[model samples]
Target: VNGQFVTDNGTNIFDIYKEELLKNPYTAENARIAASHYGSQLFDLAKNGFDSIPDLVLSISYQNGSLQDIGQKVNYGVKKTID
Candidate 1:
């Protein structure tokens, strides 16, 4: 995929995640607790196993400034087959 498309998609994903975190009470609270519990998990995961990993999610940080402006885009598709 093109860089422009990836950037736009990444921004969209960020917006959606932020919106969901704001809208969902449980998510917001759990995220706060997770931040406290897993302070460096995101960075660790990123550094250790980013490309080799699959279906992993990392959150952006506001206070620590560690992952303030990071973004990515994943491209996949669904296939339907008849047996």
Candidate 2:
């Protein structure tokens, strides 16, 4: 592998691909990995940051923040398990 999945500067999945990973691929259907070695992927980003899980729950319980807003903070986006 040209680069690692986890790095000291955090993970940037795009940089690890050496062969122009998706530079010339046609856009069609849901994306699947070229190789089946990896199990899962996570893409997490924050602009305003987030509070702990307990604090976040409290915020939602009290109507301090909307689910959409809280989702932006703690996104549990995609979960897939392949055989």
List the candidate 1 regions with Cα displacement exceeding 4 Å. Answer: 1-19, 50-83
lDDT digits (tens) for residues 28-58 of candidate 2? 2212464222322222212222332235343
Candidate 1: tens digits of C-alpha lDDT, residues 26-73: 778676555545545544554565565678566454433233423535
lDDT of 2 at 61: 27
Please give the lDDT score for candidate 2. Answer: 0.36
Clash pairs (backbone) in predicted model 1: none
Worst 10 residues of 2 by lDDT: 39-48
Show the colliding residue pairs in model 2: none
Give the runs in model 2 whose Cα sits over 4 Å from its true position. 1-4, 12-15, 24-83
